[model samples]
Target: MFKIKHVLLLSFTIIALTIAGCKSQFEKLRLSNDTGKKMSEALKLYNKKNYAKALILFEDLSQKYRGRSEAEELNYYYAMTLFKLRDYTTARFQFKSFADTYPTSRYAEECRYMGAYCFYLESPKPSLDQENTVKAIDALQLFINFYPKSERAAEASKYIGLLRAKLEDKAFSNAKMYYELGGYDISNYKAAVVALKNAQIDFPDIKYAEEMDLLIVKSQFAYAKNSIEERQEDRYSEAIGYADEFAESHPESKLLAESKELRKDSEKGIANAKSVLAARKADYEKYKAQLDKEGKKDTTTIKTPNK
Candidate 1:
């Protein structure tokens, strides 16, 4: 047991010393004034997938080689190292910088695409904030416009499609949330209708078109049902209109039955609202007639003063 313990300790110490020696050698190269050797070592590290070390060397060499012919190469490798290290935020900036600075370089187009791809990588899920998703879409679209005939244009377009889908999902989720909250605040039904309509206008080819259309019908119906008696007829009419549009547009939709029911219910609500309004009008007429009779009696009872 004692011999085994001694061997383990010796092995661990040797491994630690070896690691420390390698780190020391790298640090010495990094701090040295030998730009050429640093560049070579950085490239070697990058090729070996040692991006942490490569990034340090490349960062240092970038300053030293700035404005020189080798700067472009160093910058390209530096950005690539950052990308390989999964530092998308810095990698994207570096890639964009490289593309802009070396517009005529053979790697410019590649760098531009890579920069946009980094944005795509940074895009959060649909339930989260979508600023990065929008930026990614814009960047990818710019890439497509810049290189319409390039092979990567197709891939960029595909990525744009994916990002747009995510945006659609976000929009749908938001509108649906308003609809779901309508029970708490009836005004949310109106909000849901407006939101869903705007989403339809924004994304004419939205994958959620059928669902949104149904939601619009449902929201309009709910909005009308919760409105005041005087406004219910007009609102229910609007709901019926929306339902008709839904039915005509989505003849075979699975939600067709629900839309039809909403239409029927809206028609019933309008009828009920009209009946209530008519009763209220009759009561108001009776009250006005009583006031007129009293005014007439007072007038009759008044004796005109002699002029």
Candidate 2:
């Protein structure tokens, strides 16, 4: 029984040692005062392109110096590490937080630019949802507003312009699709009008606005031209509308002469068809009366005519 008691005490002692060793390991991490040393080490790792290890170290430093002067440096390093590691969302968040918390810090402007860049990196093609594109544009605009003299300002402005153009292209393409699919009765007017408006807004000084306006006039003319004769007066009336619009919008267009000729043809066709139909109906009535009179005379005078 004494031997068994000794074994039990030895086992308990070993377990206690193991637990203390684990506790000490955690305490070392918790109580370490080597923040600057750790930061330097992480920077070295980052400069060496050891992104994973650098990320871990920077994250630890960010936590260690949350509100200290080192905090901004720590956050910047952390965000850079995540960026190098291709962890963009976390990098974006880290940069945003750093900028927001230290807006007046020396590193603040860099953080703002990089934060917007992170969003720019996340932007997808226009075929995809434009949530990131919009965010990127807004961030870039804010960066310019705050740092108009920044060396990066021109580049940021250029990117914002490209992104806006991409979005406008998507909008224009969608509108054009409606016109192509004959969705007019379903409100194609809206699409054509919006397309022209967007082109005007986006490329007001370019040839695109002029071209889109011409297309709108053509589409409106075609829609009205398809109506029946009884419904055709409205068609000609609408054609005149497009003629007027085209004349006013593009008076010097090479297409002006053709547009005038088409209008004249439509007017002449309507008048000629109506006149021909009336003339044929009148001739048919007169021929029927003559036949009736000849038949009655023949029935009355048939026997005397034989002699």
True-structure RMSD, every candidate: 6.7, 13.8
> What TM-score would each prediction reach against the true structure?
0.91, 0.66
* lDDT score, candidate 2, position 155: 88
* Candidate 1 wrongly placed segments (more than 4 Å): 1-8, 288-307
Candidate 1 residue lDDT tens string, 149-191:
9999999999999999999999999999999999999999999
User: How many residue pairs clash in each candidate at the backbone level?
Assistant: 0, 0
Which portions of model 2 miss their true places by more than 4 Å? 1-37, 183-186, 198-207, 226-240, 247-307
Cα error, candidate 1, residue 33 (Å): 0.8
lDDT tens digits, residue span 79-131, model 2: 88888888889888988898998888888998899889888889888677889
What is the overall TM-score of model 1 with all chains considered together?
0.91
Shift in Å, residue 194, candidate 1: 1.2
lDDT of each: 0.92, 0.73
Residue 166 of model 1: what lDDT?
96
